[model samples]
Target: MACVYSMRSSLFWMMLVSLTGLAITGCATSVSTTTDKPRLAQQSVLSTLWMDRAGEYRALCHQAFNMAKLQVDRRLSYHRTLEKPLAVIVDIDETVLSNVPYFSQLIDKGEVFPRGWKVWMQMSTAQAIPGALEFLKYARFRGVEVFYISNRSINEGLTATINNLVKMDFPFADQRHLLLKSKSGNKQPRRDRVEQTHEVILLIGDNLNDFSLIFSDKPVVQRNNAVDMMSSEFGKRFIILPNPIYGDWEGALYDYQWGTSSAQKLKVRQQLYNQ
Candidate 1:
């Protein structure tokens, strides 16, 4: 019965294609193709699953925040008489909140970024990452302020992002504490803004860009070289989380060329294998 139904569906699609002389979107679901968006979504399946299901992912998140807590404590003990109040600036997506589910939805639908991202943000359903809430709340209890500086658009994602954080009971979820992207994804300006009044003792994020604008727009080799140069700061002043699904690291592989075709991307990935 299943075989018969499959055959009938295939025949219907064939007839429709013949009549219209144009291929319908997603009509060849079973056929393997190097179509960019769907292929990229397929590539993300494993990373998304790891983030959503693996206990290791949770442990890594906890490990990051644990180190953050220790650093904050150490800084507080050493700098008791600082003029500016202490603050921890954190990135929002995948740092404070787990958007694994959003990526999962995109994977299921063979979609990618900036497609349903705004809609997902507006849903305000993102959950706090493991240990994020506890650590931020601890910071607040210790008289330190927490600031959210994210690349999420201020216009499209402000209200929903705040709502999501507030719903999750994140510390300092208000307008004054949250800073969204205005004209650029470079978060250095936002970090500078935070530094205007508060002593930013710690910077936490999944991406290096969250720490400094130096990591922004760099190619793969330069980015790696920058990381090596800044090795001492990784677990100390910077709390780095795990996010394998998507990042600038991936973008750097294509030399930050956003216009590359899907098939070309696949070729590049294949060429870079084991290199």
Candidate 2:
């Protein structure tokens, strides 16, 4: 009886060791698999940092606005009289508002867009882009109509956007001058709508598409070529702000392929670095 009990005890100890070994192996495999998971959020870390912390970023924004003031002054001086009222068209995101906090949150949690975008919009805590408020106010003071043309969807972001702009003391934050995206992200139609009543002297944005449909949905080569072709208009009629974070430029890398997997996007970005 004593020998049998000892043998049973030894068998129990052997089974426990086998089960522990299997558990450790499973954990190792799980960890190994997670290493290949999507790292898209990490890619924007430097961009977010630059936008949030770099004085150069602020200087660039100030430079863009300063140039805008110069151009607007030039236009007003050259065309003292016109058939329509002088107007300036500008994009909302990245042009007039700094969304650094929202982007910083994404970097912290390794998340992507539309995940916290709506929440951020609703928060209405975004600050004015450097020199943006002052520039817009100057335009207003000079009797130039300020029109905001944004791709922010009407359904999800209209109210919050208006509220945020209004709260920030931006000129012309009302519905009449603030045009939100409806049924399309292409802003050409809205621009045309504004042009009907006002002579749009200047257009400002961070994305090339914000200026024209020519840059919309195009691949990298064509987009670059288009910029070169329209080089003369830049800083004159088309005032562009710097946005190194996310933009159509990044989308062009994927050939404008929307809804691509994070892993696939990361792979494309990596390959571009090698080139």
- Among all candidates shown, the one with the greatest TM-score: 2
Model 1 C-alpha lDDT per residue in residues 88-166, reported as the tens digit of each score: 9999999999998889888888877867988889999999999999999999999999999998999999999999999
Residues 113-225 of candidate 2: C-alpha lDDT, one tens digit per residue: 86789899988989999999999999999989999999898898888998999999999998888889889888999999999998999999999998998998988999999
lDDT score for residue 182 of model 2? 84
**Global Cα RMSD, each model:** 9.2, 6.8
Tell me how far the alpha carbon of residue 196 in candidate 2 is from the true structure, in angstroms, after superposition: 0.7
Lowest lDDT 10-mer window, candidate 2? 29-38
Scored against the true structure, residue 203 in model 2 reaches a CA lDDT of: 98
Task: Assess candidate 1 and give its TM-score to the true structure.
Answer: 0.85
Tell me the lDDT of candidate 1: 0.89
Scored by lDDT, model 2 comes in at 0.89
